[model samples]
Target: MTRHLPARTCRDCGRNRPNHGRGLCRGCWLRQWRATNGRYDVATGTGMGGPGIPKTAADIAARLEDYAFLRALNVRRLDIAARLGVSYRTLNRYDARLRQQQDTA
Candidate 1:
């Protein structure tokens, strides 16, 4: 008899994306969402004052650096935002973005 692997689905969008993160579909997850505290500017992509668009390794690296550091310390979401001077919700969004960036790279 042959064994069969279970199929997985994307958490967001719900479009049956090969499992990646917790309940996050690649389509919806691939796109940047609001930052940790749930804030955004429809007119521009500047959430926390970096760039209008995602450019330069520094921008991405800066976000990733914060995420990795916080994760390593096992800091609470709220604490992380407070320490990093950002919204908790924004931190959540940033964490996701960092994960995606790492995955792609």
Candidate 2:
């Protein structure tokens, strides 16, 4: 006897996909995973990470540079936040803080 499988669509993007049991396609799942800093919890549909703060000046500078790069790419902030494993609000806050610091210098 042979079992049959049905094609499914990703819940996020509505793209045809395999049954991954999470209702999300590979690419969508990966985006979620990356947004969560590689800590996606399927059961809860959530992500976990440490405090959202740059530990050093170098780290802050690097992140600012990364933000600039993302801006140049014209990527949406939501996408950028997901790609960087942060919340949209957090991203906005960080950007505001960084911009303020830059202006003061």
Whose lDDT is greatest here?
2
lDDT (Cα atoms) of all candidates against the true structure = 0.59, 0.66
Q: Write the per-residue lDDT of candidate 1 for residues 1-101, one digit (tens) a residue.
A: 95443446655555665544556654555454444434432212335555545358786568668877888989776666655555555666787887887
Mark the regions of model 1 whose C-alpha exceeds 4 Å error after superposition.
1-60
For 1-105, candidate 2 gives per-residue lDDT tens digits of 954546698889998876555798778888786775643221121345444554587876676678768977999876676666656665666778778987999
TM-score of each: 0.40, 0.42
| Model 2 residue 31 lDDT score | 78
What shift in Å separates residue 43 of candidate 1 from its native position after superposition? 19
Q: Against the hidden true structure, what lDDT does model 1 obtain?
A: 0.59
**Sequence-dependent TM-score of model 1:** 0.40
Give, for candidate 2, the lowest lDDT window spanning 10 residues.
38-47
